[model samples]
Target: MNSALGSRQAAAAVVLLFSYNGLVIGAYAASIPSLTARFGLAPWQLSTLFVCMGLAAIASMQVSGRLSDRIGARRVSLAMIPILVAAILTIGLAPSLPMLFVAGILLGLGNGGIDVAMNAIGVQVEQHRPKPIMSFFHGMWSVGNLAGASMLVLLAPLFAPDPQPAVATTTSVAAVLGVVAFVVAWRITPETAVVTHTDSSGTRTPIPASAYLLGLMAIGFGLGEGTANDWSGLHVTQIAGVDPTTGALGYTCVVGFMVVIRLLGDQLVARFGRRAVTVFGGACSGVGYLVTALGSGLPVLLVGWSLVGLGIGMIAPQVYAVAGHTAGGRGLAVVVTFGYATFLISPALIGSLVATLGIQKTMFVPALLLFGLVFAARIMPGREDDVAPSAEAEASWTEPA
Candidate 1:
């Protein structure tokens, strides 16, 4: 009874942590217009900021992943939460472009560290559960995105005249949420079971080739997602002729569909299997992106955006889940790093294209990228019944001191 109770509590903690992380990201996305205005940043300049953040985040993910392997994900997560909160505050208060750049780096570091640790912990939770629930955790992330975006939309009128107050208020809210997330994280179990393999000579075997294949798929999906996250609002406002608040609604639509689809992803994966889901999802996203690029009106464009959300919603969580099941923290790090590298680069690529071709035509870039997932879907983890326990899966859970 105690074990079951403990499991539920731990699962809840991880979910909350994921939600908080998503909230921070969503708020940042919602604040982009204000940030651009305040800093007088061009599209390329905004992409440059994303590049800085992405580089820092990549470094942090590598270090955090290695450290989590040695000390456990829970500890690393706990240690980084404070840093994350501080960075959020710093970003909100930054008065100049250079200061904002520095804050972006700090935010990226905090976000990357916590992201790896929590995902590692989430993998541990999935291992103990009866059903595949990783998608649901990510679904909660989409929910947080909705909540954060909605908050900004509501607060938009109040802060329209001043960008500083808007940023400060939103980030302050994130900091408070960060505190709550920290408490929840503290309640989760501290130790996660590590997965490893040994060969005939007793030497540890390399991570399975499938993990790398999944990483490639992740990169493709990340491109789609990163483009939507960084550019969706601008596309809607500038191209579709919507107000700034309504422009944010375009991203809200994307996340809204993502939340609904991801919440149901586990059941869909269980019923149809990963290959079918990945292929079909990719096709849907491709079609959706084409619609967004060619659609004449705001309503049509929003529908296309929503379809895109549904299509790619399951890709990242499933990839992370597969990596976690196969190689534990180390595997997750490698795959996530590969995936995030593409995500980070997406803004720069799209920004350059937007400069030349305009935002509407730039949608083709991610549309074409989505199709790559169809060929790569076959490499995803097979059905649960087909998977066998590895030497690392057999390792006993070591409780934290």
Candidate 2:
């Protein structure tokens, strides 16, 4: 096992990397209204663009898992920083819709690669620790969301006169943060602690049945998360009849609770166990969407969104953690890929619904998806007997600070 101090440093590096990734997404999210106005795109066109990104992400994730397994996650993760930074810069400089599509592809590729790599590292960290700490790492992601949102709130007024400057400035910040993330990535230990399934002849085995169910849960959770990240601000403005600034606040409220709950998630999972937490959290998220759909005022809508954050915050991390135990890096990739595939369809689905049924009614889609978790939660592996004893012992490796 790694020394206590080395383990702590590795954990910090992983959390910081997660935060940087969230900052990139959050900053782009805050700029969506500006992007819409600048491009003069209908909701469907925007959805199509998201589909482009999602397709690219899926492709990249398919390969990233194998690449991480071969090269070590630390190197693969550090290498993605440049690609991510370049993509962010390109998105800022894009002058046409076609250019935006090209930028989105690059962004998706970088994001997909980094996502698998970091989760692999996260699994490594979890194996050395005695408790569930994946949620705490995810909490840093929420913190990044808050930081990015706050930045937009402060900077939006200064750049409202022109969309280019707003995007340029935001992406510039992302670039700077990416540089910091690269530095942190360098500090991560090169070795991974991963559990692999092997037969007597030392051939790798197929993914377990439990992983498939976990992937399904991830897909449902992804729909809710994707909606919140992509459409929550618009929902507040279009459905609740609020100003853009106020709408941004509603999005902020959702992420704020997400940060709080995820920060405390380890204790919750330890106390209640994985199955109970998954079911309860899913139910809360369903209720939150219902409240938002029925809300007549901004205050009610914001409250509902807050609940949405609280409820959905820990699901992904828990799912990833379980995947980590079951299949290590490959499992993380498979589950995340399945989950993120919702992004491929969700934007277009929601956009079509918004065009016809309206945003309020369309919210039911995510609500239904989240509610599905009630049954799906049954598929997750229990804490006490999930990982094989030999795999656990073999997977532990020293990670230098």
lDDT of 2 by residue, 1-401 (tens): 22232377778878877888778777777777878888898988887888888888888887777666655677777777888888887787788889988988888998898898888777667766667778888898878866775676687679776766867788888888888778756765445543445665777677667667888888889899878877888888877787898899777877788889999988988777777778888998899999888886888888889888989996888888777666656677889899888767777678888889888988888899999987888666665522222243212233444
* Candidate 1 per-residue C-alpha lDDT over 217-238 given as tens digits, one digit per residue, 9 for 90 to 100: 8888899998887787778888
* Overall local distance difference test of candidate 1: 0.77
Q: In candidate 1, how many Å is residue 223 off? A: 1.3
lDDT of model 2, residue 270: 78
Clashing pairs in 2: none
Candidate 1 runs further than 4 Å off:
1-6, 36-48, 95-99, 195-202, 231-250, 293-300, 354-364, 385-401
User: How high is each candidate's TM-score?
Assistant: 0.85, 0.86
- Please report the TM-score between candidate 2 and the true structure: 0.86
Off by over 4 Å in 2: 1-6, 35-45, 95-99, 230-249, 293-301, 354-361, 385-401
Please give the CA lDDT of all the candidate structures.
0.77, 0.77
